[model samples]
Target: MSASTRSPKLRVATYNIRKSIGTDRRRRPERVLAVLRELDADVVAVQEVDRRFGDRSTALPPEVIAEETGYMPVRFGIRPESLGWHGNMLLVRRDTEVMSTQRIELPALEPRGAVLADLRVGGTAVRVIGMHLGLLGLWRKRQARAVLMCLEALEDPLPTVMMGDLNEWVMDGGCLKLFARHHHVAAPGPSFHSRRPMAALDRIITSLDLRVEAAGVHLSPKSRVASDHLPVWADIVPAGPTAAAERHHVAQSPLI
Candidate 1:
């Protein structure tokens, strides 16, 4: 599509930094930031961003992120030293306006949570949810429902996008089925085990009001070493009037 005919697009990405520990078992926060720079996303959802010990300090320091990247961490006030709730973090470009932020607790065998932000990217208002689901299938399903419930309880229903390290190995079953019932689920590609990616554990899901123009797993030399899981990104825009009408029709149509 030509520039004039194409709608404005926002690039969103999700990466599980594994606490900035690379496949080499080295803690390299700068390497993670370098990979993020390569993606050049408008907003990024990062998982395992904090150390799991006492204080739970962020792996990527706010000052370092501000100085090295074009993005800033969305502050949720969950903890003074932590940049995210649980291990989920959201980073938006410096030009984006964060209207509100929320920390959502999910049902899991271990402690797991999600971060939500209402943002104005350029002139478009959007809602972004970043999460790291549990390892077990049952907990993942319950967590998916909890996230959806949180979204429904919100007042303003802006064009929504949820992206993260889902920890789900399958494509059609598990928690993905729950998300697919209400949203467009896109597993860009296999992003797990960056050395030899064979699992599509990273994903980006969008509401019907939005359209994904392009989505893929970012595979670069830096990305391969940045973490155990590769980053996934999607270029999304508001659905055109015709597309929106068709989506509404599909929603209203009876199941076969």
Candidate 2:
């Protein structure tokens, strides 16, 4: 396959919406959605999706998101009975069929969970896991531990990508080391504490075989403080000269 014929490229986004209550004290889901639309990503992982108790965030609903934007949403949470809505969500633009989806519940100061989606994009199947860790230290570490645990148990050899509001600005090599050699960190696009932002919390970490084509932070001027953290975007291709081969090697290779 020519370089162009290699794996299809994809742009992904990770955003933490602080329950749609922006600094302006207005609920602006459309503005927030507009910012996300600007990213032009094939998929997105969102945090702080307020509506745990089945309240509406905006005039638009999850089904409306698909109708308006053509991206399907997959969301999950551990708390079954909560007035406030909080959870992780995965939205995909292509015709995606979930191979499997799960919620990793964390024992943190506030309950949190993850949403994993297996997508079929351009005839290519890839796994994308979206998560939001707890705010407290002990809880965060446990959540991170759960992340590693999930990584180690992949049944398929196909490449995978994990993105979300990790809530950790400092990289101590613990979370960084979880990925294998072919897997690596993309650009260090800072995306946290959106108001007068100063730290890097939102991120996109991919398999070593993946290379970031373009990565950055995005905050719409029209976007109010619906969330504390801004959204991050990245366009990526499978990395390395043999990334395509490795991707196809799963069926023939013993590693699978």
Scored by lDDT, the top model is 1
Which pairs clash in the backbone of model 1? Answer: none
What is the C-alpha lDDT profile of model 2 across 1-256, one tens digit per residue? Answer: 3323535887788877666556676766766677667766778887766554444342235655765576767645444332112467777764656677766655567767676667766666777888877666666777766765665566664567888877766664434444333355664565666776777777787765677888888866743365677888888776765766665553343321
TM-score of each: 0.92, 0.79
Error (Å) of candidate 1 at residue 200 is 0.1
Name the top TM-score candidate: 1
Candidate 1: where are CA atoms >4 Å away? 1-7, 242-256
* Candidate 2 local Cα displacement, residue 244, angstroms: 8.2
Instruction: State the RMSD for candidate 1.
Output: 3.4
- What is the C-alpha lDDT profile of model 1 across 104-221, one tens digit per residue? 9898779999999999887778999999999999999999999988987776667899999888988888999989886899879999899999999999999888989999999999
lDDT of prediction 2: 0.65
Off by over 4 Å in 2: 1-7, 52-60, 77-86, 107-109, 171-182, 224-226, 241-256
lDDT of each: 0.89, 0.65
